[model samples]
Target: MMKESVQADASALDGPALFATMSSMRAMRRLKPDAVPDETLEQLIQAAVWGPSGGNMQCYEYVVVTDRDMMARLAPLWKRCVDSYLATTGKYAPAGMDEAAYGRMVAAIEYQRDHFAETPALIIPCYRFPEPRIDEEGLIASAQALGPAGTEHLMNTQTRFQALAEGSCVYPGVQNLLLAARGLGLAANITIWHLMLEQEWKETLGIPEDMRTFAAVPVGWPQGNFGPVRRRPVADVIHRDRW
Candidate 1:
């Protein structure tokens, strides 16, 4: 479909239509090699900015990569990350998934990995936190009251807290981008596989040294159809008033 057609169709989605779009979104790993227009990409980012951020700081930024040569450069890095993941976390089927289902998912990932250089565009969502303003004296006093063991535990978990704070601002926007892509008839999936070689990715893309990328979303026309996404039943996961 043409870019103009995509934009028009995306904009015309009503409330129910929007919900329908959200319900049908799937991680489309197998994508066509066709180019995505810059205008459509801009619309996706525009949708992303509409999402809220922590304290409304809006610190997120996007790197829209359309250059096939650059993708070729990053393809080896992508391979290393995918290889590591496949050998480790992705090696076995998860608890509820059957081996066949897991194998199919792995095949799609391998397909995307091998064709990394051919992806039409990759959108990387990045963020960098500003210098924090906090009362150091009060924090030190609280830590001291907690004693040595508590202080050590807090120190060890500090990095994790910082990462969660950063993700709180960036991931909402990433979800918006994904939803926008689905609405526009484009295939897109959010993946953090690049975090394995984040520093190299930053250097390659000219992202600032301090900025962190949260996801690498490959976007293009899909080779297959988009349909309903299967998930656990609503009742199976919900907590009414408390867990």
Candidate 2:
């Protein structure tokens, strides 16, 4: 049964302000296999839906997966992605990232990939589109209509537009979910590398290829604690009114 509180806006939940929970939200990749109650899961979903959407038409939806067998099935796909990334990239560290820290992060993600089946809940967040957004034929048409240079620009625009649209519609909800989970003392993380095998994964989930999946989020109790996260100072990344 669904909880009454889930129906109410998370803002009026009579607890901490949802916005304040952001600082505590961290990507908790290492999780325990303990089961999470549905009512609690309901809170996360409710909070996710409260996120802002264009014209108030909330198009984001989530598929909550808790069965370990299903996760086990995804393990090989996840491994393929991780191995591909590690092999192609040579080094996992991004520019300006400390080699040691990035190495540790890579190791942790590798561990997460290896033990994905142990995760308690796998949330697949998607952007439900009305029609084909990334059709190859459409790109070819655009390429012919506009010159090749212009076609590249057109295609870039299309990709950017879709990404921006989906990001605007889906990421806020994902943020809300992370915050909600944090408030409830649960841990979660989002990964998109698995999309390398998107076709097969979508088939496994019974989701149509046309519907775009934004990312896969796994939620569970953490084996590690959420501590103060390190990041570049605001002064470094923040731009004033004019850069």
Candidate 3:
């Protein structure tokens, strides 16, 4: 598909309209089979490229899959990943979320697992740089130094900061794409459960072994409506000088 460029005024690109789009860009799972226009897709990617990368070294690659046969080949593996992910981690709900909310979340995941093959565009965001690996020696040992949950807390902190540093290079692009698609009334999903079959996918798609497949974003027109999403108050999330 030929990517098209969109000409937008500078104000529109950075104004409150962008904020509204960003806030409303929900994770769309049950996407329609209707194909996203190449122009829109291109625009989204263009927006993505505008995102900041670490040291301005943007080492990221995107594989946009639109072929139906490839989708068919991938869907079964996607379903398998979904099943594995749910069986192991889905039962663990996050803080402040109810059981009903967790169930709905699982249902949405299952929806994509079942219908990902029918998707119009399957965009894989890859880190062209090296993938990070957690070493056992890097973990904090609390009992060796501090008491209580200090070790656990320290380990969690280290992992989070490490992942954040790595993800900061790629997810900015992903977020830009999401906001751009939302502004254009396109539905897109962020799916990564397929990592379970990462090797098979890489072999089939001929992706380089060193490149990290960070996310699989499937884009299309929505089977649902845009949202006025729920979020916590700014005061609750923000800290002025300290946490």
Candidate 4:
């Protein structure tokens, strides 16, 4: 249930102010170790559940970890994932990012990795899709309707398709959590390093065998400031009516 105080405060933001809160929301990787209150965390989760999910099923569940011992146990797994990412896809800065900026970003990532055990709180968002309900006859009919190429496409892409479908429902709630964090002056950022060792994480956190965890978000007071996020100009990316 949403706390009265939390709902009132969140609801008090005017449209422009809310947009400003979002505009300045940063991926705050360098976080202070100060404890966040339970009420504050509850407020964030309350904000999250308000987001819409497919069919209003609202199957998402959150695991909040504030125990230092639990974080310590998870730290080595985090290191392996971060190390793997750095060695491969994250080896260098992308085009247009200057080396200095990239270096700072990498340093922050390393800082977060090194200090993850000290995180004030971590939230793991999870969901398990209900079993697909197509009857055998309907399934056969659908397969026949698709013919060879479409059937092959379905076979090839089913896992990816379900992942996309599931993420569509979960990510909006995650975004709401981030935005609420920003509004409350708490720093939070979404990270998916847990996916690299997902089963291990699930076992350690005692998430159910059937659930799919999406993101590992660290929340705390920030060691740095939040400001406008850099992005390409709107004209460069927008296509009105058509591409």
Q: How should the candidates be ordered by TM-score, best one leading?
A: 4, 1, 2, 3
**Candidate 3's residue-wise lDDT over 1-243, tens digit each?**
212222233343366776667656678888889887777788988888899888787888888888899999988888888888888877577666566766886888888888888999988888865555546654444255666577668666976875677689889999888888888888887777768789988887889988878888888888889765555545555788887
Q: Among all windows of ten consecutive residues in candidate 3, which has the lowest summed lDDT?
A: 1-10
Cα RMSD of predicted structure 4: 7.4
Q: What is the lDDT of candidate 1?
A: 0.88
- The list of candidate 2 runs beyond 4 A from truth reads 1-20, 131-156
The sequence of per-residue lDDT tens digits that candidate 4 reaches over residues 75-118 is 99999999999999899878666678679889999999999999
What number of clashing residue pairs does each candidate have, in the order they appear? 0, 0, 0, 0
Candidate 4 yields a Cα-based lDDT of 0.88
lDDT of each: 0.88, 0.78, 0.78, 0.88
Q: Which candidate should be chosen as best, given lDDT against the real structure? A: 4
Flag clash pairs in model 4: none
Q: Give the TM-score of candidate 4.
A: 0.88
TM-score winner between candidates 2 and 3: 2
Task: Output the number of the TM-score-best candidate.
Answer: 4
Q: Write the per-residue lDDT of candidate 2 for residues 20-114, one digit (tens) a residue.
A: 45544668888888999988888999989999986577777788888778888888888888888888873555666667867778888887888
Off by over 4 Å in 4: 1-15, 140-152
Superposing all C-alpha atoms, what RMSD in Å does each candidate have to the true structure? 7.3, 9.4, 9.3, 7.4
Q: Per-residue error at 148 for model 3, in Å?
A: 26
